[model samples]
Target chain A: MSNHELPRTEETRVKRLPEKQVFDRAALNALLDDAIVGHVAIVRDGKPLVLPVGIGRDGDTLLIHGSTGSGLFREIADGRPLTIAVTLLEGLVYARSAFESSMHYRSAVIQGSATLVEGEDKLTALGILTNHMMPGRWEEVRDTTKKELAATMVLRVPLDVVSVKISDKPVDEFEDDGDDRAIWAGILPLRTVAGAPIPSAMTPEGTPVSPSVIAQTIKLA
Target chain B: MSNHELPRTEETRVKRLPEKQVFDRAALNALLDDAIVGHVAIVRDGKPLVLPVGIGRDGDTLLIHGSTGSGLFREIADGRPLTIAVTLLEGLVYARSAFESSMHYRSAVIQGSATLVEGEDKLTALGILTNHMMPGRWEEVRDTTKKELAATMVLRVPLDVVSVKISDKPVDEFEDDGDDRAIWAGILPLRTVAGAPIPSAMTPEGTPVSPSVIAQTIKLA
Candidate 1:
C-alpha cells in the first residue's frame, strides 16, 4: 500500500462490490474538499435522523459545526456514534438496459464518535469551517464574540474509519460484446457552478463584490 | 392556515426556530421534484446509517428503490423507522460577522416506516424512479424483465410526517444593526450544471444523443 492510503478496517470495508472501494487518502481528501455539505446521521428516539450541515476538513479530521440550540447537535455533542457522508454526483450513467443504469459518484462515509471542541479549539474549528465554505471571508468578517462562540458547537470526527467509493466505470463495457450496438450509452457530467454575486441591500451603494467570491465564481465557470 | 399547508404533528414540528419551518405543500412538492437524490437514514446494529439513494415522488408517497443484494435495503424492507432528507443548497450567505455566515437552503425531512412493494407495484415504482432521474428515457430503454424486477427492492415511505425548512433570510440584516458597515455582505448563488455528453466507446459514431439527455442538458444550462 502507498503511504497515503487509508487502512481498511472492519467497519470501513466495502462488502458489496469490493472493487469500487477506494483506499487512497488523496482521493478521500479531494472528495471532502470539493463538497460543501454532508449528511450527518444519528439515532434519535430509536429512529435515525439524517441532517445536512456544512462541513470542513482540517488536516485529517473532519469538522462539523452547528448551533447549540439545535436538538440534533445537542444529542451529537454527547459523543455518541455518528456517521457523516459526503457524496458528489459526478455524472448520469446511461446504459442499454434499465437494470445497469446508474450514477457516477464519489462517496466517502466516515463513522466515528465525535468529540466536542471547547474554548479556543472551538474557535479554530469554526474558522476552518468558514474558510472552507467561503475562503478569505473569515479574515474580513468580524471576529467571533464570546457570546457567539457560546451559541455554537464544533465537533470533530477523525478520519479513522472511512469508506470511499467511486463509480465511474463505463456502462457500455458490459454491452461491447452484446448485440445492442445502436443503443446510446455514455455519461453526462455534472458539477456545481457559482453564479454572479448579488450584493445585499444593506451594503454601501458602491461596494464591490469580495475578491474571494469573484475568484470562486471564476474557478467554477 | 391555507388548505395546502401540511399538518404540524408532534414528529414533524420544527423544534428549532419554528418560524423558519414551512408548511406549504407546494413548496414541499417543488423541492422533491427538483432533487434527484436523498439521504435515507436507518438504524443498523444500533448505529445510524445514512445512504444516498435515488428518490422519486409518486403522488404523496416517496419511492426509494435499490438492489435486493444491499443489506441496508433488506433491513429497510422489513418495516423499520426511516428518515429521508433532501437538501438543496441554493447560495452561500455571507455576513459581516462569521457567526451569521450560513447557507441558503431548502430542506425537507420525512420520517416514517418503509414497506416493501412487490410484483406490479415494484415495477411501477421503478418506472417512477427512472422517470424522475431522466424523463422519457424509461420508454426508450429496454424493458425490465421479470428477473431484473425481482432482483430490485422498492420501498415506499409516505410523506406523512414531513418537516420543511427554507433558510433564505438575508444575512445582511444583522450587519445593518451591527458595527461592521464596511464589510461586503452578499449571496453567491450555487447550482449544478450539466456538461457535454460523452458517448461510450462501443456506441456507433453517428448515433445521436438521446432526446431526454439533450433536454436535461438544456434545462440545466
Candidate 2:
C-alpha cells in the first residue's frame, strides 16, 4: 500500500526534499527490513532520551519490545502522541561549501501513539518480532513461556504515519572557487556489509546457516 | 581524561550516574579530543533536534559548525539551552531477557549557551572540522571564503558535565538463568566494516588510495 493509504493524522508534516529523492517503497522497505537494531527517541518527563534497541516490522506495524518495566514504554498507551524515527545514513555527502554538504540518508519517522497488543495479538506479535530478528530463529529456539510474555511489553506503532526523506547529489557549486587546487569533493557511498556470521556457540555444530541470513546480504545490497 | 572534565554543565539529574560519570575540565576535554564528530542536540522553540555535525575539540571547548542561516545554529548563541552530546556506542549488552539488553556507550552531554568565536580560534576550528571528515584532502581543498564564514555559525559547548556508561557482558541475568540459559546466549558481536573504498572519478588517475581511507576499515571494529 502507498504511504498515503496508511493511517495518518494532522500532525504529520509532509517534509520536502530535493527532486532526486527516491519514490520506490520497496527500496525503502528493504533498507528498514534488513537491520535488526534501531535508535528510538522519546521524551521522558520533559527530558529527551535516545536508546538503541531491537525492532521488528509486521506488515505495516512496527513492533518495539521493552522490559515490562521500561519507563519509556510505560509512558505510552491508548492514544498518547509520540515520534519514533529510524534512519540509516546510506552515504556521506560532500559539498565544496559546507552549506551545500548533505547526507544521503534513508530515514523513516512514525508519529503516533502506540498501543499494547494483548492475547492472541501479543502471541503473534512476539512471533513476528522474533522472526524479524533472525530467520528460522523463532522456529529453532525455545518458545517464550507464559511468564516471559507477561513480563514483556511490546509497543505497536502503525505504519500510516511514516514518511521517508532522502538526499543524494554530487557537489555543484554556483561558481568555481578553485577548490580543485587541493580539495577533492564528491559523494562517498556507505553501506553495511555482513561478515562471517557467528552462530551461537551452543548451537548444534551441524546446523547450516539459515536462508534468512543469506538473503540479507543481497537485501541490503 | 574522563568525560567530566569537558568544559560543560550538569543536567537537572547530575546525580543519576554519580562518580561513574565524569565531570572534570580535563575528562570532558579528553572525550572530545578522541572523537572527530559530535552529535549536536538543540532545542528550537521547545522542540529537541539532534543532528550529526562536524565538531572540533579545542582545549576545554567543543566546536560545532553550521550555517548562520540555519535556524538551529542561529538560535544557539541566543542564551537558549542547547544540549550537545557526543557518543560512541562501544559495545552491546546482550541479556537473557530483551528487557535487560543494553548498550555500552560513552556519551558526553553538556548544557549551556554558546558564543561566537573570532580570530585564530575560528580558523583553527574550521581547519579541524575540515580535516575531521577527510584527513588528507584538507590541504588540497581551497580555503573557506569570507562570505562562507559570514554565513557560518560555530557554537562552543564547554565540557563541564559528562560521564561514560558502559556494559560489555554477554548476558547478565539472575544466577539461575546465567548458569543455564545464559550459556545458550552469547554476543553475536556488532562491527562496522568498510568495504573497498571507491575512489571519486575526480581523483587524478594513478593516485593510489590514501592511508585515511585505509584506516576507516576498522572504524566499527
Candidate 3:
C-alpha cells in the first residue's frame, strides 16, 4: 500500500528537470523496498564523505546498521544531518544525439538526522535490516546475542523531507535536429541477475540452495 | 596501463576493517570504468547532499556532466570539496548467524573539488563521458553545437585522494561458534545483465542493432 504523499521541503525539491519529480509516497516506498543498498553522506570536518551502506525500510523509517566502533556509526550516534540516496539504473537510453542520451533510473534521496535505535527495538531493527538484504533467512539463522547487539549500532531515519526522481521515457528527439534513418536508437535494459549459489566449502555436502534465496533472486530479476 | 598506487590520506584511510582496503590505482580505475552510475555528495548550506550521477573516467581523473541549471552542477562549478562513490554489489553473503551476514561489493570513494573544463577540453570531456556510457553510439549521433556545450557543465574530479574497499570472500565463521550441518551458508553472486535492445518506435524499420550496443551488452553480461 500507498502512504500519504511525502511532504517536500525546500531541501527536497527537484531543481533540475522538474518533470521527472515523483510525489507518490507509494512510489517512494517501492524504490526503497526494491533497493538493497544506499549511498549515505555526512560531512566530516569540512569534506563530504559518502559511503555505500546496506539498508532496510521499516515502514516509514529507514534502518541502517554498522559496527559501533566505526566512524560512520559514531557519526550517526551524534545525530547530525545526513543524506541517504538509493539509485537504481534500469537501462541505457540510446538517443540520436549524445546530449540527449541518458539512463532510465529511479532514485530517492532522504535528508535528515538519524536516531539511534536501542533496547529491544534495536534487535528488531537489525533483524529487519538482515531480512531486507536476505529475505526469509533471518528466522533460520541463530538469534543475535546481547554482546552482538551492544557492538552494533542501528539507526532509523524517518521518511520525511524526501525527493524522488524517475526517468523512464524513451529517447525524445528534437524536431530541428537532422538524423539518418538508418541509425538505430533505442534502450538497452539492464537487470540485476542472481547467479547460482556457491555453497561454502565448510558447509556439509549435498546442502541445497534454499527457496527463499531463489525467490529473492526471481524478485530482483 | 596501471598507474601508481593511490596514496592514502587521513581522509581516505580505511579505519574499520583495514583488510578490505585496496590501494592499487589500476583496481580503482577498473571499478570506475565498469560502473555506469555513481553517488556524488557535496555540502550545501552546511548540510550533506547526495545525488546519483552518470560518471566516466579520463585517465587519472573522473568526469561527470550535468545541466548548468542544476544546483549540483552549480555547486561543482563553485570548486567545493565533494565525494563521489562507485559501488558494485557482486553477491550476498549468507552466514550461520545474522550478525555475520554481509554483502560482497567493490566500492571506490574519491574526495576532491571538480574543475570546470572549457574550450577544447570541454568537448573532449563530453565525448569521453558519452562514449563511456554508450560505446559506439557517439559517432552515429549528431554533433554537439557550441550552444549545447555552453549550457552544460562538465566537471573533472582528480583521483588523488581515493579509497577502495572490496568484500569478495565467502563467509568466515567464528571458531568458537557451533555449526549446524543442516544450515546453508554460502554466497549468492549478483550481476547486471543486459536484455535485448528495444528500438525506439520512431526508428526506421529493418535497422539492425549496432555492434557497439551488442558489445556493451555482452560486456555487462
Candidate 4:
C-alpha cells in the first residue's frame, strides 16, 4: 500500500478506454486532495445508493465523517462494501464534430469497506479532516467536546484498490477526418474560485475575516 | 410525474437532516441543469461501483452516455437499479466550533433503472446532452455520424424517485453557547469560473473564440 504505483487488480482495471488509466500513486493522492467532495456508493437491499460526502486524505487512507444516526453512515461503519468516486472537471473541449467533443477531467474510483475510527485515533482523524477542509482554523476554534465526539462517526477507507483516469489533453482529431480548420476548436478552462467572505449575523461588526478564509481563496485562485 | 412537487416515496425520503430536504420539482430540475456531471452507482458482482458521467436533463428525464463497449454502460442499459448523485458546492461555512463548520451545497440523489434511448430518440438525446454540457455548441458542430452513434450508448432515467438537499444558510448558533463573537464566522463563497480559451493545434491561426465557449464562461461566472 505504501508503494509508488497503485496495485493493478481486476476490479480496478480500466477496461474501457484503457489509455486514460493512471497507475501512479502520486496522481491518485493529488486528485483526492484537490477535490473537496466525493460521491460514495453502497448497496442497500440489493440496490445501489449513492450520495455526496466531504472527503480528506490521510496518507494512504481516505477520511469521511457523518452523523452517527445516519443510516448510510451506519452501513459504511458496519463494513458494507462501498465505492467512492472523486472527479475534478477541468474544462470543456470543443471539436469540429459533436462526437469528438468531450470534457477534460481527472477522476478516481476507490473501492473498499470502511473501518470506524475510535478513541485517540478518532480525535486525530477529526483534526485531519478539520484542517484538511479549513487549513489553519483548528487551532483558532474550540476543541470538540466529548458529546460532539460521541455523536460523530468517522470512517477510514484504505486506498489499496483504486483506479484513476485523466483526460486533460486537447480535442481528438483524425488526420484525414476532413474537419474544417476554420471552425473554432479549443478548451474553455474551468476553475473553482472563492469570493469575498460574508460575515454571519453573530459576528461583531468590526471583526476581520479569518486568515484561513483568505488563504483558501488565494489557493483556489 | 409532471406534478410541481416531487413524490415522497420511502426511498426518496431524507432520513437524515430532514430539514434540508426540498420537495419542489423545479428545484430538482434547476440543480440538475446547473451541474454538468454526476456520479452513477450500480451493482457489479454484488458490489457497488460508482463512476462520474456527463449529465443532461431533458424534460423529466436525466440523460447520460458512455461507450457502448463499457461494461458499466452495458449493465445500466440492461435496466440495473442505479442511483445518480449530482452536487454543487456553493461555499464553505465557518463557525465558532469545528463541529458546526460545514459546506454550503445543493445536492440531488436520483434512484431508478435506466432505459436505453434508441433510433431517432437517441439522436435527440445526444443533442440534448451536447448542448446541456456545452451550451449552444450542438447547433455549431457537425451532426453525429452513423458510426459514431453506433459506438455511443445513451441512457435516460426518469426524474421520479428523487431526493434534493440544500444547505445554504449561515452558521448555526445556540444562545448562551459560550462561543466568542469576536472570532470570524462567515461563508467563503465559491463559484466555478472559466478562463480564456486555448486553441488546439489543429485550429487555424487567428481564429476567434467560439460563441458557445464565451457564453458558457459567462454563465458559469
Weakest lDDT window of 10 consecutive positions for candidate 3 chain B:
B173-182
Q: Which candidate number has the best lDDT?
A: 4
Error of 2 at B9 (Å): 11
Comparing 1 and 2 on DockQ, the stronger one: 1
Q: What is the Å distance of residue A125 in model 3 from its true position?
A: 0.8
Q: How much DockQ does model 1 earn?
A: 0.72
The docking quality of candidate 3, as DockQ, is: 0.84
TM-score of each: 0.95, 0.74, 0.97, 0.98
TM-score of chain B of each: 0.93, 0.77, 0.95, 0.97
- What digit string (tens of lDDT, one per residue) describes model 4 on residues B1-221? 47899988888899998999999999999999889999999998999999999999999999999999998899999998999999999999998888898999999999999999999999999999988888889888776889999999999999989999999988876555365777888898998989889998888899988888877887898
lDDT tens digits, residues A24-49, model 2?
55655765686565555545445444
Better of 1 and 3 by lDDT: 3
Ranking by lDDT: 4, 3, 1, 2
Instruction: Report per-candidate DockQ.
Output: 0.72, 0.24, 0.84, 0.84
Model 1 Cα lDDT, one tens digit per residue, B142-206 = 88877889888999988878999998887746623467676678899999888988998878998
Model 4 Cα shift for residue A135 (angstroms): 0.9
- Tell me how large the interface RMSD of candidate 2 is: 4.7
- Which candidate leads the pack in TM-score? 4
Question: Candidate 4, TM-score vs. the true structure?
Answer: 0.98
